[model samples]
Target chain A: MNERVGTTVLSLTGISKVYGEGPTRVDALRPTAFEARAGEVVAIVGPSGSGKSTLLTIIGLINPPTAGSLLINGEPVITDGVAVANLTTMRRRELGYVFQRSNLIPFLNAEENVRLALEIDGVPAHQSRTRARELLESLGLGKRLAALPGKLSGGEQQRVAIARAMIHQPSVVLADEPTAALDSGRGRQVMELFRDSAHAHGAAVLVVTHDHRTLDLVDRVLEMEDGVLSEKQPA
Target chain B: MMDLAVRDIRNDLSRFLLTAAGLGMLMSVVLAMTGIYNGMVVDATVLPDTYGGDLWVVQKGTQGPFAESSRVPALLADRIRAVPGVERTRSYMTLNVQHELGDGETLRFMLAGLSWPDDLGNSLPLAQGRALRQPHYELVADRALGLPVGTSLRLGRDDYTIVGITSGMVSSSGDPLVFASVSDALRIQNDLASEALRLERESRVSRVRRSEYGRDPANLARAGSAAPLPVTSPPPVTAILVDVAAGGDVEAVKASLLGWPDISVYTIDEQRELLVRGVIDRARRQIGLFRALLVLISAIVMGLIVYTMTLDKMLSLSLLKLLGAKQRVILRLILEESLLLGISAYLVALLIGELAFDLFPRRVLVQDLDRLALLGVILGLSVAAGMVGLRKALAANPNEVLAS
Candidate 1:
């Protein structure tokens, strides 16, 4: 990939997520520590009910971990149990998320959907529109700029969603089964896009997936089963 | 925020427009009700306005000619004219009678009797023909009576020709009015059946003949006996309408009339107050109650629509939260959509209300003040409706998107 792993951009230490208390208590994730450096693509693979999605959510700053600390660029943003005051700000400015179904706003077309992410960061409308077009074009969505989510194919919709996520140039891009809704060929294209995005933008990219056919596109792969994580050798 | 709302509405334009039009029709009815109330007030004051009299003189301790049976001597018109500052006086008599159209249809009309020439402004202005120039058997009918100017109608023993047609001359109860000469009114008021008159005369003559004077001619001659006795006594006129000279003191004239023995006087203001507070009070209350109920219903409907729309977009709202759109942004979007719907509906209601005026059976009076007040009410209602959706939006959880 001709990319050197830079400083750590996302770090999770002793993180755990518990559903309830007493007898009915369940452990969604069991005390996990993970780090991903800039210019690196990391994948967590597991079957249903594994803790892959849980750990990804914790690093994405969506749900606070039960007992853990989160550090961004080596700065503590969550300690013990409390999230910092700037968690939302950090989430908006530093973290990008791509979900399983693309989850694009149905009313907005591709260009507008991508532009919204930049506009949320207070970017000017003209600049945001320009940057949105550029990002979509780089993802090979230039001709479908005005196509609504409903009009786009499944693969095209996912590529538009990827453009939306990367338009803001966030420090970390977190994805959860983004290729689950696509075929193997489209899934490979999406995974390769993520690898290229991570290397080209010098951002940390983490993905949770069950598909093993596209494992070679990621720099490192981690396996999770029964709420536990183990480093795995790539096939 | 507006862009989002616009796009959303455009995507479902038909549904949104239908909902707004439904609300608009309801609002139109509400506005029409207000106009109806105003029309009632207008109807009640039409007489006082057309009278052009500074003061009204009627029987002692009576409200006025409209509220009660007021009887005053016809001669009192001259007496009122004698007072200083009195420019003119007219003996005014009013009564309700049914005119048979002869095809099994009868229409009730209020008959107004005043002096000919009507110099004191006691007659309604003509819209078609000349006013009553001849004294008797000539009438001026209001256009609402639907009588042509050349038509003739019978009241009692006489047929009167409709000489003039006036518009908007009606009683407090919305009955059409007909103006006739004072003499015709007196005869109509005092007219009795021939058989009844004959029987009454016979009874009187028999009583006189049976007395001692019947047997003694010498005493009868000394008593200045008459061969016949009068059969009927004329009924008293209704009231005396007095017009003061221009720039004259109405209170002074009213005070002078108040000193008389069996008469009451009312200035124009008192007459108006009596009509409004006395005759229109019940109607106003009923309309007010209806307006309150309608406003409440509109508010509830608005809230329901807004709440439904918010629930429909629950997933989108949750995703926006996950995408880091703040609570305020979501709230603003919902509120903007609500306002857009409300304003559109309000405009539609106004347009429909204006068209409905001509269709109402009674008069519908639309005033600018009423329109402005309704606008304020609608805006307030829109904000209140928006609050319902805002509550739902505020409770949106970002974590829900992750679970989905």
Candidate 2:
């Protein structure tokens, strides 16, 4: 699996996540197998508490599965049994996260929020600012760069979050309900941004959203139930 | 790498400012206490240093002129001058009394007796005009009292004229020193009233006897009526100021005065030390208490701030952790916030200390080094406080968020 310009960008085989111990243990995500390749938007759909987030978390490398292989870009990072610690540095440099609520830091302006990942990546100030400006402009947030999180509308905040996630040009972008806070029109715009960004960047974009109306933007739709995921839209 | 403390402070300016203000007030209080003590010590030794004496002889077992009552016989200077290595000795009658001015203002003045014309013994090195030259009439007063030259007032019984004023001649404990001739001061000290006025205040029977009897009543006759009234000699002179002879062995001379019954001897340096320590003791203790309390308050406030901040950011911290933010990154953020709070409060404290010192009644006398020292102290305290917050932040479990 090569997350960047590869056939399989992400692979999860025999992945399981359990909570608690002994009698109280819950297998949130049962042993599962899935793959998302380059230039694809994998929509992971499920009812609340139906293990959708668990599977997404496992795939996103935010939560490691109890038993499985999590291969990224053809390399086995989490193989058969255990997660390697050095994956954190890799994830930060190569992966981006977007939450449902836009979870933007309140103090920073939209541009600074977008530039944060670059700064964390040790990019020089002038170059990071230039890239941040360019990215925000491309995302139609040029005028809103200096506006704080509170000043922006819900749709704009999500757009800023999207920009922040994609600004680092990560090979994999994981958005959990990225359009949940916006109206239908704004939701449609957000879905379009992800689709366009994924197509242009040639990176695998995985989004777990309940809004089926904008499912057209995704290249693949996966429905999850009781830790099991099935392809709703065939390849 | 990101200057987390500054960035966080910038994010919530109002919170930072409010914390700074609170710490500033505490710093001001600490500064005020320090100033009061410094002023007191300065006031206590001003007289001893300005008087510039090599030796002081006062009554024995007394802390000397300032701490307790001290006296020597008025004529004791004659004997003291005869002692080997005695340079020059001056006798003075000093008594603490309040003077009521014509303007209804009362001031505590030390009646300093002197013999003038020669201006040998009782003289203030004139900072402004000449010393008091007239023996019986003119007076010299401390310049700290704000009295102009030639200002005169009636003290006790005599109507004295102020001919000159001197600077830096005030006595220990802030009493204005009044320079008058020895004869005049003795009159006020020993012989102000006539025989008639003395009898007038006695018992009616005792008061009438001197008038009924012969004008010069015999001692036996006087003693018969008054139960052998022990002659209470003039309240012995306050203290005798002594100057060592040119190339005088001051140590040897001081050793001789120790044998004199009911008298203590002190060099100028020793007197100044006693005076300074005496005046500053109480103020020192009070200031020390204030310093301790301010430090405790600073520590507590910083700790509370760190704790509160950690609690507020717990969810975000957990989210970051879940996103594979290493514990070191989390640790850095927690440490940064803690330090940010401490440094902000320290700056606030410094400003407050400056303002408080400026407005306080006494001279605060804060130097640059004190500021630097205080800054160091604040930094140490801040880091200590932040540790409390950092501990809790470190303990926060990313697994907690997933539970619910």
Candidate 3:
């Protein structure tokens, strides 16, 4: 499957992050190299304070790497230590994010929450609404389209968040503990959704998680320890 | 942006409306203050408007007839009318008096005396019945006092019939106007009290004369017949009103009147300035201060409310930023909500203002132009208020989403 898909959706070389300088200086992430090809779902498992979040944020273009180069869809977004253009626009065009909590806008209903991303991208309102409804229904949230975030249960909220993340079909999707609040069964279901998202939409999915039970759903598994990353071996 | 704002307000419609209504009530008070000032101006000019006089001739060195007391001869109207370029002349007198209804309801009224002949330019415009036609015992009262035609009331030992009724007739101080013949007003205001005093003095003198010569009736009759008591006449009028001939130079007429050392003349413009700047100066300042205070309170209240709403949505806004929303998107959203709040409050304020105007004891005049101008000001101020919330929203950090 990796041989069939030759394009790299996200790639990073010598990526490093430093908090401050001198005595207060803290290296959140050491210089590292990473890549994710099209049609692959990669999982990063680590203990707390392992810099998994910092690495994900740098890859997602939320925080610029202190020393590195980043490429999305084979296009250079960051060279050396500076961004080429507007990072916000770049993030909106190429990246999708799902946080640990559902983080849905409480005022908006499920469909509206999904449509907001497209609306931010300057999509026409009518088209955005229709696409949001279709995506939510595809995720088995058809009846919950008009329900506000507070009205939905834990699993439903996570599913709505998933729909929002995948609404724009970006080149890469970065999710941090996407199902930390759900039970084991629901967590596995969400991980399977990520796998399907990568294969069906050809998106490169990167998820940071502690749930080892859903490791079988990803094409490759990596481990982070004190800001360092290495591929995991088969059990 | 509008759609998003509309939905957000609809989601919490009760909270949004309550905030808007509170703001609207404050704005209504602002409107009421403005209306009160307008009403004061109207009241200040109502008497002059009713008289329609081009110039006023009063005692020298006086601002009469509203701002100061002036006494001139009643016969001056004839001389003033004879001056070149003088179209017409009418001697007028105004006495501020309290009419005791005998029920603890003492109503302040302006008793105005106008020239006779029952013609235009001298009589008040009646809303019902006829103008004052009788010389000594007729009155035309303002309808605001609820005085009906044919109602008779005693004024200074004389029963005067209400022969006419006029609307919108008020004094410079907002007292209702009551018009009567010049002689009737003069006698009622000046002669009646002096006449009573004179009779009492004569009676006392007669008694003293009888006491001194009680033993001799013939001597007493001779003394009473030999020395007659003196009579007191009514005091002169307050001012005389003059009209300029068609297309006449009012300055020429005024200059001619200045030659008379005992009297002064004023054009319409001069009287208006005296009334607004001099007469009502203190009240205007008070009203202006109240308006400024209300506006300041409105801005603070509006800004605080929007800032609080922004605080409430801070978390959600941070999540949006994390999800890749641009700063403009978030800023637009907050601004749209602020605009909606402002417009809604203005609408509620207009309704409340109309209701309050009808119930206020004094006149509250709300003009259409005034309302529109107020609305524009409120909307603009509301937008200014949005900046407070916009700043809060902009200061939201997207990294908070990860921290949570």
Shares of reference contacts reproduced by the candidates, in order, are 0.30, 0.19, 0.53
> What's each prediction's TM-score?
0.91, 0.83, 0.92
DockQ (C-alpha based) per candidate is 0.49, 0.34, 0.59
lDDT of 2 at B42: 61
**Number of the top-ranking candidate, with TM-score as the measure:** 3
- Residue-level lDDT tens digits of model 3 in A1-235: 3332547988889899999999999998998899998778899999999999999888877788899899988888988868986788777778888878888888899999999888888898899989999888888999999999999998899889888888888788888998788899999999888877676667788999998988998888989998889899868
Q: Model 2: per-residue lDDT, tens digit, B1-404?
A: 24445566687889878877777677656655665566566656655655566898888887678666776786787789899988777664566667777789887777677744334334466666666666686777776667888677776566777766766455545566777777677766654556655574464445435564424568436645645355445446777878888898889999888888868998888777777677567767878888888888877877887788878777656655544566676677877776666666667766776666666534455556666766676778767776887788777664444442
The sequence of per-residue lDDT tens digits that candidate 1 reaches over residues A1-235 is 3243487888888888999999999899888888889888889998989988888778877788899888887778888757974776777778888889988888788998888777766788899988889889988889999988999999999888888877887778989999989999999999999988887777888889988888888999999988888788855
CA lDDT of each candidate? 0.83, 0.73, 0.84
Candidate 3 residue pairs that clash: none
lDDT of 3 by residue, B1-404 (tens): 22667777888999999999999999899889888888888888887777767899988999877688789988888888899999888878888878887667876788888777633223567788887656778888888777799988789888999888888787767788888887888878864576677676678557757685534777666546636444343468888889999999999899989999999889877887888888888898998899889888889999999999999888888877877788888887889999999999999989998776878867888899879988887888788889999999998887777777
Rate residue A69 of model 2 by lDDT.
88
Model 1 CAPRI quality: acceptable
lDDT tens digits by residue: candidate 1, B103-194: 87888888878676654223566789878778888888898899899998977888889888998777777888888887887777677898
